[model samples]
Target: MPYMGDPTVSIILPTYNRLAYLREAAASVFVQTYDDWEMIIADDGSSEETRAYLRAIADPRVTVLWLSHTGIPSIARNKAIGRARGRYLAFLDSDDQWRPAKLAVQLDALRVSPDCRWSYTAVDLIDADGHPVDRDGLAPWVPYAGDITERLLWIHAHIAIDAVIAERRLVLEAGGFDERQRFGEDYDLYIRLAMRSPVKVVDAPLAVVRAGNGENYSANRIEAYEGWVQLYQKHSATLPGKRLRAIARSRRAENLLILARLYTNAGQSWAALRTLLLGIPGSLLTYPPWAWRAAKEVVRACFKATQRRI
Candidate 1:
């Protein structure tokens, strides 16, 4: 089935004080092979320079919504979505740039897989200097198709928001982005989308994600983990079957283990021990041996420390 209508892909960009990078990002969009697109930039409390830069852009396809600094990307994103007129929607962060063929390839894939309402391409990680980082041969994503709700919830794979494009209606049906989530908001939205339909994947790397660019909205690991916990609480009840719920529990346990490690590294021994104990039951339910192994590792570390003191 051939795609119909204007074929305009609305690019939703939410930015805050990243003027230099935003210019590069917008340039990438302008150079896209698929040119029938509108770039809606939601300025979330940027400085005068940023606003002036946006105002100076002469392109008629570009639209800017100057909003008060809400400190929430989701809020900015939702505002852009409200004003979007394109049949398809794509997201690009201010600090990320796409290959010229990025939109073209994703749009082609979606056209081919008409049943798949949304799709994502693989991404290459670039350092602050914009050079590709070597990943020791690990792909950005594990390839999978069809209903990926359980797989996503279990954290077996991930879809980068910057690498994705979706039918506008489907995104709206997924409730855009959750405003309440300060971190992992994209992850929460992705889960809801996967639950609705099977997501398609474009195997090619078509986007460049700027790593460590100093505009790190997701810099707080602890708060990010807490957001994940909140997502589990929000969606676990809606998931189907005992197995899916079990996976959710295991994921929770895994996050707790991570939190405990963070605490241990920061010299909060008592808190680490308590968190580890809290995680034990769920860990045993998921993989009993892992709980035992983690306990043994903790004991060994404690024993080694005591011996050094003696």
Candidate 2:
């Protein structure tokens, strides 16, 4: 049955060419225990089959926006957000899914904590075939609550966008996602939002994230690291206190060093050298040991290349 009046929550789902995964994700939304919700699916020029499936959605509460392929999730999600009419906003990627009680639990948390404008839940990591993957080495699940801006800045919180439910106005106040960022856009938005309001947490894992899927955009390590560097540069100065600023600088330097190592491993010696040099100022100001580690990476690459010829 078609729902009447405005929904309490609006789900912003962005998709590319993953139709198989899209079906499962969309179905998860349809099966949610909470029914007074709408889903806005932003399709970034998917194939005809995907388009057909979207168009066949008979649910009046669902809206599909078609855009020319930008290959940018931020653009698609921002468009969907602009069209949202609900009081609260939720996010779900095309490859992820939510448990039936996801919305109910998060909504209850926000209701009890009237001061909080956002809430997030833990997530279960799954493989492409939907099999559970061990979270052994991944960031430990922490039930973070209240003002988490510093935690986000320090990269201590593992808040996943797909597991989040935030007030629509707060999301708009944060200016939505940065369109220029190809990756880590969610982290950037979360930091901005956390600065404005405290957040609640649903301790249970109610979201399922498809991990180690090579088809996902964030699977590209170089681009992901570059995105983090851009975020640090953009927000470092705005961070309050000298301690936070120093942490930002150190994190930026670490990302640059990681990128440098990646370039060295790929045999791009000149690029590696340039990246290492770029990180030097931050390393000197914050963590000087990273400078030596980056230098070693460059030297090791050169030595390996020489040994190969001999």
Candidate 3:
């Protein structure tokens, strides 16, 4: 369907060299049940094949912005966002696809809740081969609505970037994605947005996310944990209320403990010890539970080291 006027939603899709997945991702948007939408594909210096594929798109509703390789998704996404011509904005990763009614359902939810400018839906996890996979060890795939600021602050609410449809102005007011953050940038944006307004939810799973892909940054355990710690600390200083600040601190401490364990498993005992020491102050300041958990992890690491020495 050709839309003459400005679209209701502008889908910001950032892509790199994943031409095959990008093809499928774009195709999903083309088949959406809702028609008043435009898709902006931001290319992050992909190979000629991917560029050629993007150029071949005949749909006028779809626009492609070519940019030099920055290797930072936030930069590419922000560029696409700058060119978006819609009241609402949605995101679809190059590796993810959406169900046919995704836009229709999310738009309906937003219409019903006039005050809610942002919405997210549950997502199904799929492997690189497009086969359904179990979400083991991942946060629960559930729908959360209304003021989710506290849940987001505590890292309890999991909102996938691909599963969101937010107002364009709200996204801009939230400062877009934090360009400095390489990992967990989406989480950072969601937290800021939730703090600004109530969120609506589409209870059904509409987005299909590709998990366990080697290209995923979250696969790097140590770096991902470090990114989480940085994210928590960044928000801790700005988020209102002493209780919220404490929650942020405690969450940061948890990530630090996890990072220490990762370092210990990699046989970097000194780094692990340093990480544990760094988390101590925050853990002590917030409450006892996290401090106790930190101490237990320290003892376990020491025990493992002693066994290796013996």
Give TM per candidate: 0.85, 0.95, 0.91
Q: Could you tell me the lDDT of residue 59 within candidate 3?
A: 96
Q: For candidate 3, lDDT tens digit of each residue in 72-140?
A: 899999999999999999999999999999999999989989999999998898998999998777767
Clashes of 1: 0
Q: In what order do the candidates fall by TM-score, top score first?
A: 2, 3, 1
- What is the Å distance of residue 27 in model 2 from its true position? 0.8
| TM-score for candidate 2, residues paired by index | 0.95
RMSD of 2: 1.7
Q: Report how far residue 56 has shifted in candidate 2, in Å.
A: 0.5
In terms of TM-score, which candidate is stronger, 1 or 2? Answer: 2
Candidate 1 Cα deviation (angstroms), residue 254 = 1.3
lDDT of 3: 0.89
Q: Least lDDT summed over 10 consecutive residues: which range in candidate 3? A: 135-144
